[model samples]
Target: MKTFTLLQEVVHIPTKKKGQVITTKVDREGKQMVEVKYENGTTGWSIPEALTNFIQDSVDHTGEFLSD
Candidate 1:
């Protein structure tokens, strides 16, 4: 079976009031997929390529964190 490793990062979402949690996923090819879930159980997906930058940044941060 062909297997692909999944990478994930948690990002802060600006909410109407405060404290919103958003999840983002990045594939090996730099494709970004996002999911946002509301307290009411509503959810949505976004395909903004802007997430690639965030994914890279997070990966760098993780490496730094692990090295320390």
Candidate 2:
């Protein structure tokens, strides 16, 4: 399974809120979705691609948090 752990905080576009990407998975539509735990303590899922404006290309390190 593919996944990612964002090293820095990012804004979830749909909510226009800043949060950490605590988890990720490929959803039913085959989109790489992120489950963000926002600063408000609420969580939401969305494709990180939409937040590209601030999330530079290098920060997207797939499976970087996985363990053996």
Candidate 3:
């Protein structure tokens, strides 16, 4: 588990279905990225202030999640 912030922007478009959303974030490297969150609580992306800079696929129950 890690800590990060989310910007109110869409790096990419996501499904309008429940629990599926795409957001834009500035990672720890200061790179703007697109993140897609799924209904199952899994996610795909890089978030602000994260340790890694790659899109990851994992469940994130925490309100705050960082992609690997």
Candidate 4:
């Protein structure tokens, strides 16, 4: 299992709201997933592909933050 430590995905949400939190991870099966984790511990999820594209575009724009 792998986990990303930052709320980088929150920026990708088009709504642009603050105070929201998310937790994204890769399960043992390697499927990419995102969870909207709240301060209260409840959560929701989305396709990591959206984040993949967001990161890709950012890298293309600034040539930074590449991952392996």
Candidate 5:
């Protein structure tokens, strides 16, 4: 897991649905962040670590994916 402090304002994010494949970009320090644009034309930011734990937990329960 990684963390970051945003240096600049994000301009856009593509729409994403549940279970959709999304893209993440990391800074030089390896902080994982996702850029998302909302329906109302607002950008949203999220850290992968915030969701990684939950996803890993779910996968662990179902044995569908492996977590390290």
Candidate 6:
């Protein structure tokens, strides 16, 4: 499990919001999926690649930026 903040708003997953990725998994079809916990207490599944700019960084999760 890990946390992540979006670089921009994604409106299609129930609402246009920002959230932290709580879990990552590979489905039976071999596709990568991520479970995100929105700021509003909602959870949804999406592909990591689907996120516009979801990049991983070695910096602290508490930091404001996830990438350069």
- Whole-model Cα lDDT of every candidate shown, in order: 0.42, 0.68, 0.44, 0.49, 0.43, 0.58
Give TM-scores for every candidate, taking all chains together and pairing residue i with residue i: 0.30, 0.58, 0.27, 0.34, 0.34, 0.53
lDDT of 3 by residue, 1-68 (tens): 43334423222223332233356656787677556565566677743333332234333456867799
Find the candidate with the highest TM-score and give its number.
Answer: 2
Model 1 poorest ten-residue lDDT run: 1-10
Highest lDDT among the candidates is held by which one?
2
Which candidate, 3 or 4, has the higher TM-score? 4
* Model 5 spans with C-alpha error above 4 angstroms: 1-23, 50-68
Rank ordering of all candidates by lDDT, starting from the highest:
2, 6, 4, 3, 5, 1
Query: Which has the higher lDDT value, candidate number 4 or candidate number 5?
Result: 4
- Name the runs in model 1 displaced over 4 angstroms: 1-21, 49-68
RMSD of each: 9.2, 8.9, 12.6, 7.2, 9.5, 8.9
Off by over 4 Å in 3: 1-21, 38-41, 46-68
User: Which residue runs does candidate 2 get wrong by more than 4 Å?
Assistant: 1-7, 52-68
Cand. 4 TM to true fold: 0.34
What's the residue-level lDDT of 44 in candidate 1?
57
Q: Candidate 5, residues 19-38: lDDT per residue as tens digits?
A: 32144687778777775443
List ranges where model 6 is wrong by over 4 Å: 1-15, 53-68
Candidate 3: what lDDT? 0.44
Candidate 4 residue lDDT tens string, 1-68:
33344565343255332223366567778786776554445556655433333343456455578799
Enumerate clash totals for all models, in the order shown: 0, 0, 0, 0, 2, 0
The TM-score measured for candidate 1 stands at: 0.30
Q: What tens digits encode model 1's per-residue C-alpha lDDT throughout 1-68?
A: 11112334323233332112365677678776566444455665545432232344445443334453
